[model samples]
Target: MNYTLHQLQVFLKVTETKSITKAAEQLYLTQPAVSIQLRNFQDQFDIPLTEVVGRQLYVTEFGMEIARAAQNILNEVQAINYKTMAYKGKLSGKLSITSVSTGKYVIPFLLADFLKQHTEVELVLDVTNKNRVVRSLENNEVDFALVSLFPDLSVQSIPLMENQLVLVANRDFPMPKKPLTLEAIQALPLIYREAGSGSRFVMERFLNQLDSKGTKKMELTGNEAVKQAIMAGLGCSIMPVIGIKNELQNGDVQIIPAEGLPQSSQWNMIWMKSKNLSPVAEAYKNYLLENKSTIIQNHFGWTEQL
Candidate 1:
C-alpha cells in the first residue's frame, strides 16, 4: 500500500496526458522508467488502474479516484514548498499558466520582463482554447489563466488589457470603400474559430445581436489557421486584433471597415480565489496588473482607444 511521491507523480502525468510516452517526455524520464513506475504503482493496489485499448490508455474508475487524490497530495506538497520558500523571502519555483490561444500574442510579452527579473523561477505556459483553459483552472492544474471571457463568478478576475475583435480579409479580397453594414458583413464568406473559442463566442454573440441568421462559411481550430485561410482567400474572419498584428503590419490582411465593428472585449487574468498561489504566481499577477498596459503599448503600439 506504499507508493513514493515520484511514482504518484508519474501516474498523475500519465493520467493527465493519457500517454505514457508523453508523460515520460514531460517528466524527462525514459519511457521504460515511466512504465516501470506505473507498473509499480499499480502493484500497490489490487484493482486495475488503467487499461490500454487500441494503443490508447484509458484510466478506470478506480484509477480516476486515485489520480484525484494524487493530484491533491501533489498540490499540497507544492503549497508547503512554496510557503516555505516565501518565509525565506525567496522566489524560486515553477509557475504554470494556461491561456486562450489569442493570449499567445500577449502573455509572452507580459512574461518577458518578469522572467528576466526572476531568473530562478520556472514558467510553463500552455496556450489552448478558452474552454480547456477554464478546465485547467477548475482542476487547479494551472496557477492562472488569461482569457477574454470570464467563465464564472467564482474566480478572481483582473482586467489586464482591452481585446478588440475586428473583421479581417485578405488584402487582395475586394473590400468596400465605405463601411459595410452588419448585414452586409454577415453575407460575406466567413472563416470562424471552433465553437469553444472565446473569439467565436464573441463573434457569435455579436452576430446574434444583429439578428443575423447566416452561418460561418468555414470553421478552423486555431487563430493561425484562420489567418492562413483568410490569406489564402478561403474566407474572411473576425479575429482578435492582437493575433493579427503581424499580418496587418505586413499588409497580408486588412481590417474591414464594418458598421458596429471592432467589438471590444477585456483581457482578464483569472485565478481561483479559494486556491493559494505560489509566490511566483502572485508576483506575476501583480506584475501584470501594474505593468501590462505600458508593456502592451510599448510592445504592440496599442493605444487606449483600442
Candidate 2:
C-alpha cells in the first residue's frame, strides 16, 4: 500500500525483462536503485513476487496478478495524461510501435512525415518477427504493430499497402531462361526465414498449396540474414520485393521467374480493438489511413499497384 508508481514501474520492468540489470538500463537507473525499489514493492505486499531458479527469474502467480493490475493503472494514468494534452490541443507523448522485420523497409518512410509534424512526439520502435509482434499487441504492450500476415482476427487491422514476395538467388546462380513450375523451384535448396517469421508463414502456405515439401538449405533469423545467405550462393529464398529493391537493381541478386510465384499479401497496421486509443495514437491511425496510398506511391513508385 505504501508503494509509489515509480516502484510499480520498476517492478513491472523487472518482471517483463526478467533481469534487474536490464530493467535498470531501460529505466535509466542504477541496478541498486532498481533492486531497492523492487525490494520495497515486495515488502509492501509482504509476498514473494519473483523467484530466481537456475539463473532465470520467474514471477509468482500473485506477482503476475499484481503486474496486470499495475499495467492497468499505468494505462489509466497514460490515458489521463493524453486527455489533458488533447484538451490543450497538444500532441506530445511516447509512441510505442512494433513491426515485423520486413516492415523496417517501409514503416520508417511511412512515419517520416508524421514525425516531422509532431516534433514533440518520441517514438519507440521494436522490429521483430511476426509472432513476437503479435504477442506484444495481444498484451497491449505497444500502441501499433505493422505486419504482412494477419494471424489474429480479433484485433482490428487497417490495410496499408501490398507486399510482394519474390524468389531471389545470387546473381551467379544458374537460372532457367523460362519460368519454372512450383515443383521445380521447390526442388532447389532454399534459404528460409526462421519459424515465427511472417515471410516464413507465407512461404510455408505457398509450398503447402503446391503439394511440395521444399528442401531447406538453412534457416536464418531475419530478412537481411536470409538475403546475405542467398547472395553468398547458399540457396534461393522468397523475399519481400521492397526489402530487395536495391539488390535487385544493383545486380547482386536476381529475381527468379517461376510459375505461381510472387506471392502477394498486404501490409496491415493493427491494434487491439478492446483497448482505448490515446489521442496521439488515434491521430496516428487517421494519418496513416489518410496518407497510406499517396505515401506508398510517392516513395516506392508503386502508383500503378494502387
Candidate 3:
C-alpha cells in the first residue's frame, strides 16, 4: 500500500509527543483530522493502533513497532529525494567539516580553492586532535574528518593521502654517523604527541613491531609543541613529515632515518556511513579526490601518493 509523506510526518509527530492533541497542534491540524489519518494508517495495515484507558489514548504494542518501521521508511524515501535533487548539479549549501590538528595545515588549503570555485557555498571547519575529531564524527558533529591514521570506526573512509613518518631532531643535537633502527631510537629520550593523535599511534606501532614498548617518551599535545621540544634538544621523536616541512627546511630540525619504518602511512577522509551528506559536502569530496596531489604539493611543497 502507498503512504503519503504527510501521513508519515504526522505519524512521527504523534509518536514523538505521545498525544494526538499535541501532535495535531504541532502539525497545525485539528485533533479529528489527526485521529482520522492515524486510523486510516492502522486500517491500511489491518490492525488497530490505539486503545483507551479512561480518557487517555495510548499506543498499542503493535503501533509502537510500526512507528519504528515508519521512521526508517520515511527516512529512506527522503534520502532518495535528496539524492535526486543533488545529482542535477544544483549545489548550493553549507559544508561542515572537522579534522585532526595536522589536517588544519592541509584541508583548509584544499578547501580554499574549492570555495573559490563555488563562491556561494558556506564552509565551516573545526580543527582538533584525533580523539575529539572521532567523537565529533560519531555524534554527527561534523560532515567529514581528515585523519592520518584510520579510526577504529564503522564509517565510510576515503583514502586521500599518505604521509611518511620520520624521526626529527634538532640540527644542533648530536647524531650518530649511522642510521638508527627502531630499537636504537627507543633508547633515546623522545618527545611525542598525545595518545590519540595519529602520528603517535603510527610511531608507537612501529616501535612495538621492533620489540620496543615505547615507554621512554614525553607526551605533548600539538605539532608545534613537539617541534619546539625537539628544537630545544628534547631528544628525537617520530613525526609526520607533513607537519615538519618548514622546520626541516629552515635547518631547525633534522630528519633522521629509521629502519623498518613503512615507506608511507595512509591518511583517510571519513564520515558516518548512515548520515546524509549535503550537496556541498559531496562536491567538496569530489574536489578533494580530483585535486589530491595538487593539494598536498601546494600545502607541504611535497608530492603525495593519492
Candidate 4:
C-alpha cells in the first residue's frame, strides 16, 4: 500500500524473471538496487515474497497475488505517462496496435503514412488473426486495434471504412443467373478464414441465419493462402471488396451474387474506454480520419476515392 509504482515495477520484473540479478539486467538496474526495492516492497506487505528452493527463487502464492495487483498498477501508470506525454504536445511515445491479418494488406500502409507525418511517434504493431486482436485489446496488452465485426467489447470502436464482403471465385467458374441464396453458395466448395477471424465470424453468422447447413468446405489461415486457393479453383471464398481489387481488375476472380448477405462491415479503430489516448494515438487517429479515403484508394487503386 505504501509502495511507489517504481518499486512495484521492480518487484514485478524480479518476480517474472525469478532472479534479482536477471531482473536487474533486463531493467538496466544494479542487482543490489533491485534487491533493495523488492525487500522494501515486501516490508510494506509484511509477507515473504520469494522462497529459495534449489537455488531458484519462487514467488509465494501471496506474493504472486501482490504481483498481479502490481501489474495492474504498473499498466495504469504507463497509461498515465502516455497521456501526459500527449498533453505536452510531444508526440514521442510508444503506440502499440494489434490488427487482423487481412488488415496486413492495408494497415501497414496506413501506419506508414501516419509515421511519415509524425516521425516522433514510436509504433509497434502486432499483425494477427481477428480473435487475437480482440483478446489483446480486452487484456490491455495493446493500445488500440483495427479489426472487423467483433463482439461488443468493453472498449469503443470508431468505424473508419465500411466495406462489402464479396463472394469470389475463379473466372473459369460458372456464373449464376440470379443473386445466389445461402443454400446455393453453401452448395459450392468454400475456402474460409479460420473460425475466430472477423471475416469468418461475420460470414458464419450471416450463413447460420440463412441456411442451417452452411459450412466451410476448406479452411485457410491467411488471406494470401485463401486468394491462392480460390485462384486455383479449389473453392469459392469471401473477402472484402477492398482486399481483392487487383484480382478483380485483372479478371482472375469474379464476384458471385449472394442475396440476404450483410451489406457491409466496418474497419474499426478500437481502444479501451477507460484507457486514455496518448498524443501519438491521437495523432494517428486524426491521420486515419483525414486520410482514410486516400489510403483506401491507394490500396485498391480505385479511380474515385471512396
lDDT for model 2: 0.86
Deviating ranges (above 4 Å) for candidate 3: 1-90, 210-212, 215-217, 297-306
TM-score for candidate 3, residues paired by index: 0.67
How much is 165 displaced in model 4, in angstroms? 0.9
**Residue 182 accuracy (lDDT) in model 1:** 79
Q: Pick the candidate with the highest TM-score.
A: 2
Sort every candidate by lDDT, greatest first.
Answer: 1, 2, 4, 3
- Candidate 2 residues 122-192, lDDT tens each? 78999987778978988878999998888764788889888888888999987898987888888989988
Ten consecutive residues with minimal summed lDDT in candidate 2?
297-306
Cα lDDT of all candidates, in order?
0.87, 0.86, 0.78, 0.79
How well does each candidate superpose onto the true structure, as a TM-score?
0.85, 0.86, 0.67, 0.69
Model 3: per-residue Cα lDDT over 1-306, one tens digit each: 776778878887888788899999989999999988887776788776677788777778887887888888886885676566557664556688888887876776768888888766667788998888888888886889888777778888778667778878899867678878667778888887888888888778777776557555588989899999999887778887778777876999987766765446777888889888866778888888889777766665563431
Q: Clash pairs of candidate 4?
A: none
Candidate 4 Cα deviation (angstroms), residue 21: 18
The lDDT, on a scale of 0 to 1, for candidate 4 is 0.79
Q: Would you give me the overall lDDT of model 1?
A: 0.87
**What is the lDDT, from 0 to 100, of the residue 115 in candidate 3?**
87
Runs of candidate 1 with Cα error greater than 4 angstroms are 1-5, 40-89, 303-306
